[model samples]
Every structure is written in C-alpha cells, then in structure tokens.
Target: MDIKTATALHRLRLASIPEALSFPALLIFGTGFRLALDYDKLVMPLGIIHGVLFIIYVVLLLDVWNRAKWPFKRVALFFLLAVLPFGGLFGDRILKREEQAGVIAARARKEGTVNA
Candidate 1:
C-alpha cells in the first residue's frame, strides 16, 4: 500500500479505539444513573453520547473495512466487539496487532526483504 492509504488506515484505527471505548463508558454511566441513582435526566444525554459514538464507530469500521479488506468474519467480530462491555479494549488490542503487523510487512517490502 502507498503511504497515504497506510496513514489513513492508521488514523482510522486509532480513532476507532476511543470511539469504541466511549460507548461502553457511557453505557456504564447510563446504567448507573438509571438503576442506582434513579435519575432519568442522565439517560438522555448519555444515550445521545452513546449514539454519536456508535455512529462514529460504524463509520470508522467501514473505513477500516474498506482499507483493510478484512474478511466478513473479522468484520463481524469487530462489529460484535463494539457492542459488548469492555469489548473495545479487546478490539484495540487486535487493531494494535494488525497495525504492528502491517508496519512490519511494509518495512519488509520496502527493504526488498522476504520473510521466511
């Protein structure tokens, strides 16, 4: 891949991590506010925040999907991870691994070296 595409992929991957995390954080806060505090006011704002984050996560997922050309299973897995509590942390680790692998592969290709 060219430098620009690689850079964009990197940015998308990085952007996804925070957005993914935000969803769950808001989820916990919303749950806490609703169940423990018995407050409805916090629900709307937290819901809005989660909604926005969900949209961002989906958009980033699409960008990553297009750029990475990941298989359907992997794509679905990432989508699944987006919804589960603390799943974003797992997703972030996977993305980090992918990024590292891509960097290594790119370096190898650029250096005209083949892995065995």
Candidate 2:
C-alpha cells in the first residue's frame, strides 16, 4: 500500500469507533426526547445529527472499501451494521481487527517478509 492508503486506513480505524457509537446513542436519546419532551425543537436536532453522522460513516466506509477492495457482501454487511441496533459496536470491532491485519500486512510487505 502507498503512504496515503496506509494513513487513510489508520484514520478510518479511529473514526469507526465513534461512528459506531453515535447511532445507538442517538436512537435512545432521540426517541426518548421525542416522546417525553419537545418534538420539533429538541429531537429534530438529533435527527439532523444522525443524518450527518450516517453520511460521514458511509463516506468512510466507501473509502475503506475502495482502499481495501472489500467484496460486495462485506460492504453490505458493514452497511447493515450501521442501521441495526448496537451493530455499530460489532462493526467497530471488525474494523479494528481489519486495520490491525492491514498494518501487519503492510509491515510484512515493507520488510519483504511477504511477496507483493
């Protein structure tokens, strides 16, 4: 992998944790606030927030998919994780493992331990 690709992988790994977390939190908070408090005032902001976070997550996912050359099924699974309750955590774990593996591969390639 080139320098930019490796750096992008690290950036994606860092962003995945929070991106995975935000949706669940938003789900709980947004629903509760909508039911218990003001509708248009408070919860609306949360909807917007969720939309923004979701967009960011998708963009990051696409970038990772392109850099990593993930298959269609893997990409779909990750996308599904974004919508499923608590799925983001699972996705985060998978992404961390993937990043670690990628780092290992990159290092091996750099040291000529593995054939390119």
Candidate 3:
C-alpha cells in the first residue's frame, strides 16, 4: 500500500483501540465512585458515550487491519490493547512509528538511495 493509505489505516487502527477501551474503564471507575466514595452522579451518560465510541473503534480497527494487511500477530495485539487500559495509546504510537518506517523504506527503495 502507498504511504498515505498506510498512514490513514494506522490512524484508524490507533483510534479504534482507545475508543474501545474507554467504556470498561468508565464503568469500573464509575462503580468505585458510587460504592466507595458515595458519589452517585450521572454515570450512565458516560457509559453511553463509551459504548458508542467502543463500537466505532471496533469498526475502524477492522477497516484499518484489512487495508493495512497487518500480520495475524499484529491484529491480535490490537484486540488485546482494546481490552487493556492505556494500551491503546502505546499501540497507536507503535503503529505510527511502524507506518512511518515503512514509508521511509519505500521512498528509499523508489529513489535507489539504499542498497537492496
């Protein structure tokens, strides 16, 4: 794939991971706030928002993974990150770096700037 397509897919993949993760965290933390701190407040709204984002993230991840032709391992890692708190951010960074590296390598190859 070209660099732009790769980059876009990488972004979508990155975005999907965190969006999928936020819902569970909100549910857990919101529960804590209610039981431990007696801070009952508007939690359902957050839950609703997270739920929507989670679905969006999943769809985006699928699109990106398919277009990018990521290996099976990478695809698995993406799913794992969706379930792990803060893992999405790390995944996003890694994917971006990898995409950039691929773009650079492709450019180098096209220009015959590096030995193959």
Candidate 4:
C-alpha cells in the first residue's frame, strides 16, 4: 500500500490498542467501587463500552495486518502486547516507526520521479 494509506492504517491500529487497554482499567475501578464502596449502579455500562472497544480494536488489528501483510509473529506479538499493562504504548511506537519509514521512502520515490 502507499505511504499515506499505510500511515492511516497504522494510526488506526495504534489507536485501537489503547481503546482495548482502557477496558480492564475501567473494570478494575468499577469492581473496586462495587465491592469496597458498595456502589454497583452504572458499573455495567463501562463493561459494555469496553467490550465494544475491544471488538473495534480487534477489527482494526485485522485490517492493518491484512493491508500491511505483516508476518504471523509480528501480528501475534501485537495481540499479545494488548493484554499486557502499558504494552499498547510500546506497540504504538513500533507502528509509528514503521509508518514514518514508509512515508520517508514514499517521499524519496516521489522526488526521484519528479527529478527524472
């Protein structure tokens, strides 16, 4: 894919990772409130949001994998990272590195074409 498309897809992949990560954090606080504070009301909605975001993150991961033609290991690593605390941020950095490199190559190629 072209650099712009790659960058956009990378962004989506990175964004989704955080959305997936947020779910468990919310769940922890929500559960603590329910058990410790005895506040159970409206806790279920956070779960629903988390579920939806998790689904979206999975979908975006699949899309980026398909478009980028990433190796199985790379994809698996990213998926695994999502499960770890603060792992999503690491994955985002990797994605940004790949995206920026692609963009740089694209620019060089375009410049070469114009110069020729």
Candidate 5:
C-alpha cells in the first residue's frame, strides 16, 4: 500500500493495544469498584476518558477500514471485537496480522507491477 494507507494500518494496530485494555479499566473504575470502594470522584472522569477513547477508536477503525480497502465484514468484526469484554487483545493480534498481510500483499503487487 501507499504511505498513507500503511500509516493508517500501523496507527490502528497501535491504538488497538490500548483500546483492548481501556474498556475493562473503564468498566472496573466506572462501575462496581467505585460504589464498593468509595471512589465517587473517579467515576465521571474515568467514564469521560473511556468515552473519548472509544470514540477515537471507532473513528480510527473507520479510517483504517477505508484506507486499507477492507471488507465490510472485517470492519464489522473489528468493531464487534472492540466492544466485547476481553476482545481487545484478540482484536489487536488480528489487526497486527491483517496489517502485515496487507502490507506484504501490497508490496508483492507493486513488485509485480514494476516487473511487468
């Protein structure tokens, strides 16, 4: 792929790492622990932070999907993984693998075009 597309994939892959862990962190702090442990001060801020990150991640996911020319199913699956309880880790790995495959295939296609 071109530099811009490649960059998007790279960024999305990186973002998935944090996106994976942030949900549970947000859930833990925003929910049970706060009431059970007396952390009222933390709820609003943590919820806000998680909301921002979630928004950012969704935007990035869409951008990467478009830039990478991904299938609708791929994008949908990624979104599903993003929202699942512990799906982020799997999502990150899947993105990494997909990104690598896309880059490699793009490189091969470019080489074939140049050779032709």
Candidate 6:
C-alpha cells in the first residue's frame, strides 16, 4: 500500500489499457487484411507491436502482482483477461475503481507507514 506499490500499480494499470486494446485491434486488422484485402504488408508490423505490448503487459503484471501481494485468484484473473479481446477494458475499469477508492494508499496511511 505504500507509494512504491501504488506507483507500480498505477503504471501497470496504465500499461494494461493500451496493451489490452492493441491485441484486439491487431486481431481485427489482421483478419480484415487477410480477407477481402490486399494489405498483407500491415500484418507483420502490427503483430510485432502487439507482441511487444503483450510482453510489457506480462512484465508489468508480474511486478504489480509481487508488489501488491494480491491473491492467486486475482493474479489468474488478470492473466486471463489479458488474452481475451476487449478484456483490458474490464480490467481497466476494475483497476480505476480500486485506485479511486484508495484501497492501498488508505491502508498504508492507516498503518502510519512511510511512503516506501
């Protein structure tokens, strides 16, 4: 609940939004390009971009999971959401709600601990 944890969570939450969206976008574009289109040139670049975003998402997810000390169920849910199309939106909503509620920061403040 300290600042470090809060910051890491925030970063992860932000990163996840784009990462989640990119996957679906890539899928849609890929399908469209493959069928009824001659724009095959776009596939590789988009695939690479989505791949990188996915890697970033996984790394951030791990870092946040470790810092937050979240339960296994929560970690699994996030991981599952990452692979689903449009799932990132749901994840973002949950994270935003939790962030606004100040769940972690409030707990840290109540404990009278430093921002570490």
- Local accuracy by lDDT, each model: 0.75, 0.75, 0.72, 0.73, 0.78, 0.81
**Best-fitting candidate, measured by lDDT?**
6
For 1-116, candidate 5 gives per-residue lDDT tens digits of 66578778788777776776777877675777778987687778877877777788889999988887889998999889888866867888877776787677678777785342
Report the Cα lDDT for residue 101, model 6.
Answer: 59
User: For model 4, how does the per-residue alpha-carbon lDDT over 50-89 read when each residue is reduced to its tens digit?
Assistant: 7776677667777788878889998898877776666777
lDDT of 2 by residue, 1-116 (tens): 65456566667666666666767677567878778875646566777787787788788878878977789999899888877766777787777776677777889988999998
Give the lowest summed-lDDT range of ten residues in model 5: 107-116
User: What is the model-wide C-alpha lDDT for candidate 2?
Assistant: 0.75
TM-score against truth, every candidate: 0.77, 0.81, 0.69, 0.81, 0.81, 0.83
Report the error of model 4 at residue 52, Å.
1.7
**Preferred candidate (TM-score higher): 1 or 5:** 5
Worst 10 residues of 2 by lDDT: 1-10
Candidate 3 per-residue lDDT, tens place, 9-92, comes to 666655755575675668778877788888878477767877787667667777767777778888788778776777777777
Q: What value does the lDDT take at residue 88 in candidate 1?
A: 72
* Superposition TM-score, candidate 2 onto the true structure: 0.81
lDDT of 1 by residue, 12-101 (tens): 667666667676677677878789989878878888888887787778778777877778898899888877766877887877777777
Error of 2 at 43 (Å): 0.7
Model 1: residues with Cα > 4 Å off, grouped in runs: 1-5, 111-116
Q: Which whole-number lDDT from 0 to 100 does residue 18 have in model 4?
A: 57
